[model samples]
Target: MTVDRDSLTELRDLARAFAAERDWGPFHTPKNLAMALTVEAAELAEHYQWLPTGADHELDERKREGIRHELADVLLYLIQLADQSGVDLRAAALEKMELNRLKYPADQVRGDARKYTEY
Candidate 1:
C-alpha cells in the first residue's frame, strides 16, 4: 500500500511513448493490447508449462531472465491497455482486493479454493 503513485504514472507514460514512437497508436486498441497482454502472459506461463511443483524454485538464471522479460511484456501491455481504456489500473486492483475480501472472508473461506458464490 506504500507504493509510489508517480512510479505507476511513469510506467503508463512510458507505454504511451513506446507506442507513439513506433507509430503503433493505430494498433494499440484496447482489444489489441488485451490480446497482446494475454499472449505475453501465456509466454510467461510457458516457463512453468511442463514443470513439476517445485520447478519454480529450480529455474536457472537464463530461464529466470526469460521469465522476467515475459513478465515485463505482460506489464507493459497491461499498462497500455489500461491507458487506452481510461482505467486506473492500480485503483482497480485495490478496489478488486476489497471486493474479494468481502466476497471471500478469511473466516469463511480460509483454506478453501472454491468460488465465493459456490460457498
Candidate 2:
C-alpha cells in the first residue's frame, strides 16, 4: 500500500492541533515523546512475549486484537515522532540499508548469522 505525503501531513497537523488544544505540547518534547514511543512499543511486545509468532495458531481472539491495537499505537507514535522531527523515514531507512549492504556484503553475510566483521 502507498501512503500519500499530503494526507500524512494533514494527519500530523490534526494530531498536533488536538494536542495543542489540550495543552499537551509541553509533555511532547523530544525526550518525552521518545520515551512514550518506547513505552508503547514495550506494550506491543508484551502481548507476544511467550506466544507463537503465527496468526492462525493463537488461542485467544481478544489477545490478538489487543496486540494489534497496541502495535498500531506504537506505529502511530513513531509516525508522529518522525513528523515532528522533519525526518523522512523511508529515505532514512533506504540510506541506512545502503550502508548496511556495504558493511555486510551479501557474498559474506548471506545465510550467516554472525557479525559483519565475522562475516
Candidate 3:
C-alpha cells in the first residue's frame, strides 16, 4: 500500500509482532537489515538483467508481476530497517534529493547527461 510514516509504523508493528513470535528481533539489527535490503534489491535487479535494453515494457507479464513483488519486498525491508534504526527515512531521502539538486541543478542537467563534475 502507501508508504507514509503511518503506514510504515503499521508495517513495523506487524513486523515486530511477527519477529517477536519467533524471537527474531535479535537478528534484525541495523546492519543486518541494511544488508538484507541490499540483497533483496539485487534479487529484484536480477529479474531484468537478461531482458533487452530499453525493452522493459515488453517483458513477460508474469515477469513484470514478479519484479513488482520483488520491489515491494525491498521496500518493505527498507521500511522495517528504518523503523528499527529510528531513522526518519522520508526525511533522509528528501535531504539526499536536496543535496543532489544542488549538485546537479536542473538548468545545467535538463538535457545534459554529463557527470556532476563535468558541469
After superposition, which runs of candidate 1 have C-alpha atoms over 4 Å from their true positions?
Answer: 1-5
Pick out the ten consecutive residues of candidate 1 with the lowest summed lDDT.
Answer: 48-57
Off by over 4 Å in 2: 1-11, 52-56
Model 3, span 1-119: residue lDDT tens: 86655666777778778888999888989899899999999988888886776276768888888889988889888988998878887788899999999999898799899989987
Candidate whose TM-score is highest: 1
- Reference-based lDDT, residue 66, model 1: 89
**Candidate with more favorable, higher lDDT: 1 or 2:** 1
CA deviation > 4 Å runs, candidate 3: 1-5, 54-56
On the 0 to 100 scale, the lDDT of residue 111 in model 1 is 97
* Candidate 2 local lDDT, 44-72, one digit each (tens): 77877787674657648877797889887
Q: Tens-digit lDDT track for model 1 on 20-118?
A: 899999999989999999999999998877767527577888888989999899988988888899999889999999999999999999999999989
lDDT against the true structure, per candidate, is 0.88, 0.78, 0.85
TM-score of each: 0.90, 0.75, 0.82
